[model samples]
Target: MTDIRRIWFGSMSKTLREAPLTTPNARKGLREGVHWRGVSAEVHLGYRKGKRVGRWLVRWRLPDGRYKQDGLGAADDGLAADGVETLNFEQAKSKAARYVEQERQKQQDAGKAPIPTVREVVEAYAAGRKARAMKQEGARPDDAKGRLSQHVLSHPVAAKRLDVLTDEDLADWREGLGAELAVSTVRRIVNDFRAALNGLPARTLKRLPATYPMTVKLGLKVGEAEPAAARDGAALPDADIRRIIDAAKAVDKAEEWNGDLFLMVLVLAATGARFSQVSRMLVGDVQPVQSRLMVPTSRKGRGQKRSTHIATRVGADVIESLRPSIAGRRSADPLLERWRHRQEKAKPGARPEWVRDSRGPWKSPTEITRPWAAIIEKAGLPVDTVPYALRHSSIVRCLRAALPVRLVAQLHDTSDKMIERHYASAIVNALDDLTAAAVVPLVDAERGTVVSLRG
Candidate 1:
């Protein structure tokens, strides 16, 4: 009593005759639907045509008379979706079936609910989050939202929804990066992905802690070496220290007019400042004064509570040799220009362009460190060291010279906790010297010979 017809997309069609929902072809992308007389019950299913085909069908009725079955797109997607059950619409069908069966089992026993779809979590993360949070702040979307677009929402993973995401899928997306991206890059993406998924009810997204782990353990780091110990205050060993200084000097002497490499190592050894802090300074901060400029804004001095001066104790000789004269200019001006003029005059054979851009201007901290390690290698050092280690070297030098801890902490721009974490071993070694200082004989009475008792 109802009209039956075929709906065609491309060269294919779904008809009352060929619908998989009511036919054996229903195994994979086989289209079948039946139109009954006077009633609106119809069946439809799918067919996927590849080397190994897949079929899945769903049958449900609209409470209204507009009844039909669900496997429409799979039949013609043209691949044997069965080859990858987790990928096709047919896979979604199988997933829904398992979910339904599980829900029934739950109902018969105690009480539990089906995991919500990935689409559900996504909508909530978007509406309940991104949209409102960005607008409510009355600003454009911040970096979090920007990263979200790249990691999810716009990725295939987002298309599937959160509940359906497996650790494998996350790994695939991450590994697909063309080359080896930095750990920091992978870490950032995972951070954004987790924030989105975790916005769902805790019951929904499983192993939020485990997502980050999968990226490190399962995919990227399978054969990577374990990192050497890194503490906030770890110093470069003395040999490495000497190597870095030697490399800097050699590199400078080869191109004496340029202070870029020379001053970097000097600050590194003298202050134990991070490469970032040293490189960011204009020529002004590297003042050729007797003291290192422990700027409040410096990475090493960023969090200090008061004016803290770390005595570089480099002495007037080194200061006068390197200090830039301002021609009555303020200390606020950068120091590189003076080095540039001197380098040009000293290396009269070298062009300005040749020396100025050794690795280029406004070099990033990491950029400086990369070559620093190279220079150390050229200088014949066995171990690689970074700029921050110089800070560690400085700390040890101070402790060895016996500067006060509270003063060291303030100068280093960190709490004693950070210093203790990094320099505990060096500090421990200094204790023997401290004990020696305390052993001076405490004279008893005016006439008594110096009697050795616990002082």
Candidate 2:
């Protein structure tokens, strides 16, 4: 008994706005499109393959030739047969039907084109990026790009819109993908969406979610300082770190032609330094007096000109690991020159184009993920863990020891908030040890209810 009318400025049906299957007993083509107020509406049978099923599914073709479909499947009367639905027929379709009419009344009469949904926008954006990147470099992004798009952008969570993203939405998504995908999967999705927002030029960019909504849901982390930091793609643990290092050490030429891939990871694990820091460090950047390695400010992170500090433990490890090739070299030497030279040389020679420096430049952090990932897989470690996790692990260790996150962030060169969001509960166990160390002596030496402590 729903009112059905034709929507048109003239003789043409123009667009079918409300294609409603009003009742479980409704007949399509019996009533065709109906109108509410000045708007026209109708319901069309949605078909799947050869099966013509009657469900809540309807496509509202607005005036400007644009359309939006009701995803509700034909499972219920007047629903589509696709097995994908936003609403079920018998119960949800009628309610959905009302909106169809409302939309026509509000929009179609204006002769305006319909706006695209979140799914359409994301598809367009991703496809747009793919086209641009292909044309710009005549190639795809490095391997990290492969992992991200395949797992994060194209999977179940990809179509979620920024406005629709909720904590529950992300949490459910994180758990759903957790078993099938790597931790990096979620991280990469977050990064992809974030990059899409930040990197793409558009007025709608600001409306996107600034961080992965799951950051809070995955559990809190112990950062160098903050109460939260979002976890990333994946990171190797200490054992895997050791394994990767050993495998690299045993590679064909661990010496002379350094295994830049493994060595870079080792350096990140030990120093928690960002890729730019590890790559750009010159022999002279290492100061024995300060026990620090100074590199230029990175374009990533804070985006300011400042030095990144590599802790003594991490710094010493990198220096010792790289000592063989660098021992007799002068301060003018680049720390990573030899490795870069050897890697680029591994490919077939097209003849030498000398720019004076055999090691042309150190790689950015983003470029270092691929071969290191290969090394991890070869070493029988999880393929998901990447180099940045080294910094997180290092931060985790420091956090467990009750080292302040402020100090950790200061040392590691990232935000404290980023640390806390990603670190796991295992950090509590680490912190417990520090707490125990703090209290054990006090408990043992108590002369009164509480012993006086030295200032």
Candidate 3:
């Protein structure tokens, strides 16, 4: 019943004497005892060194009558180094069947159907975004590439073929990422991935997967009560603000401090400008006569320049104080000089010098982070308080002063909706002030019964 001529025992011939021994077929490279035939492939069973060896060696005949042989995999039992189950005889047979089915399907699929992977789609989307960004003035090329690198390309699901991707696969990926990343961050990344996949052209792939399942939630469900408020920095209290300002002034007077640290903090509080926006401000951007400061186009502005009025008297004072330093400087010179550490020599033990540096009116804001942190620590402020808190404090103060939300939004170059969402507490305080100022309490002469009235 078995083919003895197709089996070769090799070194196990003496040990496997009870089993059938035969010569290998030079044409097929197949040594076999019993070869099982699938619809279009064959699985060979044999022996080597007295141990049973098997493999799925596909032998299919094309329409032209020529035969093609493909060695699928080893059919013997073994464990992979990663501990995943290796293909056994039965599994190999199943794989052989699937391979043949895939081949048949490929023939029906027009012979050249492209099966692009998730990685390919992500790459294509990133490239398209980069090209579009390059066309726009002041657009950073690395922004698109960074989003892909951080959110989509590094994901394990990126290796999966697009045609076979399922909602379950995406859900699993989200679940895994949820373990390491914040839920909001995970949601954003997942949405970005979905957007990238959906943005792929129809001709590039067969079909896109379903939408992402989990919506971003800021609060826990009924059974789970965890603080889920979106933590986007806080408005510094007036006491903390005063303390920080004092500390910055003290640091400015220090021997090692080479730049105007106090002015930076004062500018952020007075104008509600981002660190980068303030750092990039030129000496010419300050208009003391008009009482206005021109904030250049930033990434947040989508590259459109905007102007903010100097709303506070203290702000005017701060600008006037800095005018003398920038008097002899060109309009293209930076209004504020940033400090950098320079070594006297290239040697490792050389003493460092603190030098002021500027780039054609643009001073880098990152240079101030270390000194700002030290000042914050020395001021007895919260360790978590950041430089951006100064802007938040300015916004809250403006809102609490009963300034119109639209006007405040215009001053910050942001939307009223953003102010309402981020400074709701300040809005409430302003409302309280309005009620106190407008409403009057009436008292009866005898009983002292009070009634609040408003015109």
- Each model's TM-score? 0.45, 0.44, 0.60
| Rank list by TM-score | 3, 1, 2
What does the lDDT read for residue 16 in candidate 3?
Answer: 15
How far does residue 202 in candidate 3 sit from its true spot (Å)?
Answer: 7.8
Best of the candidates, lDDT = 3
Per-model CA lDDT versus the true structure: 0.51, 0.52, 0.60
Candidate 3 Cα outliers beyond 4 Å, as residue runs: 1-115, 123-154, 198-233, 255-257, 301-314, 339-365, 445-455
Superposition TM-score, candidate 1 onto the true structure: 0.45
lDDT of 2 at 346: 36
- What number of clashing residue pairs does each candidate have, in the order they appear? 33, 32, 0
Could you tell me the C-alpha RMSD of candidate 3 in Å? Answer: 12.6
